[model samples]
Target: MTQLIFINLPVADLDRSIAFYEAVGATKNPMFSDETAACMVVSDVIHVMLLTHDKWRSFTDRAIPDAQVSAQMLLCLSREDKAAVDATVAQAAGAGGLPDPNSPQDYGFMYGRSYADPDGHIWEVMWMDPTAVAAGPEAFAAHDLTPA
Candidate 1:
């Protein structure tokens, strides 16, 4: 069986988070949703659990990091091509997210950009050329993922 990933994140507002993710083309899993949390189905193998702050606290002893104050996590999504990555990032930005100013890296095989959601969760949108990576790391040298 193929491995799957479920990323659980704490959200300040459940409804707002649901709207934000929906704008970016994700669907909610009604089975796991409630007033305190919702399951976002990114794909068949990927899901995100968005929990209200209070509900999230119930599941963890560690304090939830204030997204505006400090970094907590970085989620990344891969695309089939560079254009696909760009489009997705654009959609995220249009839906109240902001692009990160960090430098880009183009290893010839992979290119990526970063963005932050309304709640300050960081995400990296990336595209990779499998053939280039298959050749070797040499293909990635000096490639800037950020625009010139």
Candidate 2:
């Protein structure tokens, strides 16, 4: 069976978070959404469940860390190409997210950028040359592969 990932995040404003995610290309899955939580579909196998603080408390007793001030983990997603990575970050900025909390990384074969949502959840978007990946490093030394 195929596995799907549901990233559960505690959000301060359900509506704002929904709008922010939507602006970055995720579609709201109303089937799993209510006032307390919303399921944002990022892809066929990727979903983000945004839960209100009160709703989050029901699942865990630990205090919800202030995402703006501290980070527990950094979430990342892949894109089709370099341009797609930039576009996602731009959309996020337009939606009130902080663009590039981290510096852009360009390894020629791989490119990555980041953005933080209004609630301060950092997400990295990356792209890698498929040909280079498939061919591997040895192929590059053999002059058989080059990143575009």
Candidate 3:
């Protein structure tokens, strides 16, 4: 079987997170979802497991951070162009998330924006040019260095 990746995140309310992800275009995956988790498929092989904090604790001993004031990770999505990035950010905002205070960045080959989910988890929506990226690693590195 081909490899797949699942990103498991602790959520205060599984149903709410599920609703938010669905609003942002993710589809529910019943195979890994239940009362404790709402699995949302982000791609053919990339799934997000929105587990309740209690259920999440069953899988680890670590404490879940208070997402209202802290961030544990940043999930990023790639887009086809700058407009796509803006649209994604807008969609996320409309679904209850808030746009990040940071300004957008435009490298020669890429552009991006960021937003924070209702729980304060950050996600970046970006657009990159494959042809420009293929030109050289320097371009990619240069793009990454630009302030966002």
Candidate 4:
């Protein structure tokens, strides 16, 4: 069986998070959804579990850090191409997500952008050229790293 990923995120507003995710192309899985939690399907093997703060606390005793104040792990998703990466980040921004405070990345063979959800969870959308990846790190050294 193929491995699947379920990323659990604490949301300040479950409904809003659902809407935000839907706007960025995820579909809701009602079978695993409730008033306190919503299952957002990113792809066949990837799912995002949006849980209300109360519901989240029930599962873990660790304090939920204020995302705005603390750095948590960044979640990244691969896209088909650079345009796809841009489109997802644009959709996220249009849906009230905050664009990354830092500049976008463009490494000739790779491109990426990031945005913050309503609850401040950081999501990065990226695209990497398969040929470039296959070529390996030598390709990176051959190209200019400076942003255009």
Candidate 5:
């Protein structure tokens, strides 16, 4: 069987989170959803479990850091092309997400943009040129990687 990923996130408002996710292209899965939790299906292999703060506390004793003020992790998703990446970011913003706080990244072969959800979880949407990828890392040799 193929391995699947389930990202469990602690949310302040279950319904709001679900709505945000749905607007960002995920669908709610009733099978694993309840009053305290909802399974957001991002793709066939990727699912996000949105848990209420109280429910999340039941799973761990650690304090839940306020995502708005803390750095936890960045979740990234790939799109079919550069346009798709940009479109997704726009959709996220229209759905109440914050646009990228950092500068945009454009590496010729790859392009990416980010947005923060209502709870401040960072999600990066990116796209890579298949031809460039097939050409291997050597194709990026001319790109500067040194710290300024």
Candidate 6:
């Protein structure tokens, strides 16, 4: 059975968060969305749940750390290629996210960039060459993911 990942984040504005996620290529699953929570599907196996503070509290009593100033987690999503990674970051930025909050990573075979949503949740988009990944990390000496 394939395991699925559901990253739940607390958002200040559900509507805005939904819009931002949609811009970044996540489609909202109406079947699991409501006024207090939105289930944004990134792929067949990945889903992001944007929850209101009230809704979040019902699930966990722990204080919700302000993602704006402090990062709770760095969520990453894989793209098809380097261009797709850049495109996702650009889309997030166009939707009001702060681009490149973290330093970009470029290994030629593996490229990545990040953007912070309006609530300051960071999402990293990455692309990796399948051939390079199969060869492992030792294959890249200086930004070369695959050995020629």
> What are the lDDT scores of the predictions, listed in order?
0.82, 0.93, 0.82, 0.91, 0.90, 0.90
**N/CA/C clash count, model 3:** 0
Runs in model 3 deviating more than 4 A are: 141-148
The positional error of residue 37 in candidate 4, measured at the CA in angstroms, is: 0.6
Q: State every prediction's TM-score relative to the real structure.
A: 0.86, 0.91, 0.90, 0.92, 0.94, 0.90
Sort by lDDT, best first: what order?
A: 2, 4, 6, 5, 1, 3
TM-score ranking from best to worst?
A: 5, 4, 2, 6, 3, 1
TM-score of 3: 0.90
lDDT string for model 3 (45-139, tens) is 88888888889989999888887787677788898888888888888888888886457777767777898776677888888888987888866
- In candidate 6, position 22 carries an lDDT of 92
- Candidate number with greatest TM-score: 5
Please give the RMSD to the true structure for each candidate, in Å.
2.7, 4.0, 1.9, 2.0, 1.5, 3.6
Name the lDDT value of residue 137 in candidate 6.
Answer: 62
User: Could you tell me how far off, in angstroms, the CA of residue 55 lies in candidate 1 after the best superposition?
Assistant: 0.8
Instruction: Point to the candidate with the largest lDDT.
Output: 2
Q: In candidate 6, where is summed lDDT lowest over 10 consecutive residues?
A: 139-148
**For residues 1-148, could you state the per-residue lDDT of candidate 1 as single tens digits?**
9898889899987888899898788999999899999999999999999999899889889988888668866788888898887788788888888766345556556788877778888888888888877868677665654556
Task: Encode model 2's per-residue lDDT on 1-148: one tens digit a residue.
Answer: 7899999999999999999999999999999999999999999999999999999999999999999999999999999999999999999999999999988888777789999999999999999889878988764574422323
Clashing pairs in 2: none
Clashing pairs in 3: none
Model 6, residue pairs in steric clash = none
Clash counts for the predictions, in order: 2, 0, 0, 0, 0, 0
lDDT of 6 by residue, 35-139 (tens): 999999989999999999999999998999999899978988889999888888898899999999998988667788999999999988899889988888666
- Report the CA-based lDDT of candidate 2 relative to the real structure: 0.93
lDDT measured at residue 39 in model 6 versus the true structure, 0 to 100: 100
- Candidate 6 off by > 4 Å: 140-148
Q: Backbone clash tally for model 5? A: 0
